[model samples]
Target: MTKDTIIQFHNVRFCYDEVCAINNVNFNILENSLTAIIGPNGGGKSTIFKILSGLLKPDDGHFSLRKGSTIGYVSQFTDFDLSFPITVLEMVLSGTICKKVKPFYRYKKSHRDKARNAIKRVGLEMYEDRGINQLSGGELKRAVIARALASDANIIVLDEPDSSLDVEAAADLYRILINLKSDKTILIASHHLDEVIDIADSVLYVKSTVTKFSSTEEVKEKLGGGIII
Candidate 1:
């Protein structure tokens, strides 16, 4: 069966001030597929994701998502302010605030249910009421993922989800991501390609341009090493 295309980038280009991040980039992401974007440190992987997450506009060309599609972003936990006294449930609940239409928006019972379910999905149910600062590295990562899932987004974009994780924790994260792909279209940008290569349905190698690979072999052949620097 042919899957529906979730996102399409047609000769997209973006520049930060005078520096071009991505130029003439093109790719399409299919529904219910997990795609890993890998590249060098200064490559345009971050640009591609920023565009996808609606955090930035393309300076040129076309970047489109399926009509009415929403994106949920899971940034690295390190990007969060851990010192803040916020519970896991509260963190996840904030994800739903973006969809609020009223000037004085309030979360409904259904929203809380979704947040609870999202926490369960990431296996963080036990820590739902725990303060975010109290969680370990792996648990914090899962909490952030749960926050994204709580938004009921059709596409999930994660930036270096395994950045600070140990080997076992990284493996655990991959498992959670694989399970997520059964329902959500997932995009992850990681320098640790080997960790995600086996689980990803496809790979997007981004430099100033983008190329899609269907298999790990092709990615290995193109990237030169199984792990991207």
Candidate 2:
């Protein structure tokens, strides 16, 4: 891989049982650039996200991350048991727990400080100590993003961040993502074509196959008579 390349997928293929999740995909995510993976439903968008985040491995092909690269991931919101008490601060700090760190080890002061800063960055300072259940939908999404930022990863990947968010909330999240692109390579799996086209430095269009475009117009051209939205 080139020095500018932070993540590379060479002829990658992935499958789950009988379903083909990804098919012979190849792409390079440039350092410090914002890339958006956009496609229709069942277009293998989430599968690609999983592959890049290391949550799932490809069934075939080669995938590589640059040496010493760190990755942070923000997943979609799911049904959480509000009764399982956990503070927002604690949830964000959990990102700092490295693989080498023992589960029994307590988080240090530095970890707490980082979590606080992350929460502040996402404009959630007042909600730091609140229970996870207490946050509204937008607030919960911001808190999850704080956790990702707290990870301090070189590459940050988010899955459907705008899901279930109102228009204002989604716009706020997009602004945060645009700001973060300067410091970290940002990749998102989104169905929000307009938002993605506006901020993305490159576009990854996933279908039965995967294709990468350097510009929105290029992506539209390749869509071959299909509307971008």
Candidate 3:
């Protein structure tokens, strides 16, 4: 692999019990670039994130990352209760739960410091002590980003971050993403074309596979079909 490539998919293919998910998908993710994954429902967009995040293994092909690379997945914790009695700081700290631990195992003061710094980095310093249940949708997403930052991961993958937010909230999220683009390799699954067109350097339109991988400005012109989101 070249020094610029961070993740490579070699003839990647995936199948469900009987249906195909990804088909001969080949792509390369470079360092410090934002690649937006876009497609309709059940178009294997989530499957791509699952495979990249190690939540599921592809049936036929494989992916490889740069040595010592770490993926900070933000959307995998969706099953947890949003109303749970946890502060934003506590939730962010959980991102590195297994990173440093002793036999007794309580979150260290150092961990809290990292979480605090990450919260501030994401513009969530004011919400550090706020309850998760009381946060707005936009605020919660920023907190999740803080969690990813605290994980000390160079690659951050978020699945459908724009799913539930309003236009204003989505715009807020987009601003944070733009701020992070200078340093992190972000792979987010989103359908909002308005947001992705502005934020993504490259766009991966995956309809069961990679239909096109091109500059954001050329995607609409080259895709040969209408983009729903």
TM-score, prediction 2: 0.93
Q: What is the C-alpha lDDT profile of model 3 across 1-229, one tens digit per residue?
A: 7899999887888888899988999889999989888878888888888888888898887899999898888784468588789999999999868855667778889999999988998898988889999998878888998999899899999888877799998888888888887888999888787578668888887877786566765876775334574
lDDT of 2 at 11: 89
The per-model lDDT (C-alpha) reads 0.87, 0.85, 0.84
lDDT of 2 by residue, 64-173 (tens): 99999888888876645666688999999988777786767888999999999989888889988899989887888888888988988889888888878888998888
Q: How much does candidate 3 score in TM-score?
A: 0.93
How many backbone clashes does every candidate have? 0, 0, 1
Q: Which model scores highest in lDDT? A: 1
Poorest lDDT segment (10 consecutive residues) of candidate 3: 220-229
Error of 1 at 25 (Å): 0.4
Displacement of the residue 104 alpha carbon in candidate 2, Å: 3.3
lDDT of 1 by residue, 1-229 (tens): 1249989999999999999999999899999999999888778987888888888999999888888789988875555788999999999998878554778788889889999999999998899999988998988988888888988898999888888789988888889999998899999988787877778889998889988998888888877655547
Candidate 1 segments whose C-alpha is farther than 4 A from its true place: 1-3, 98-101
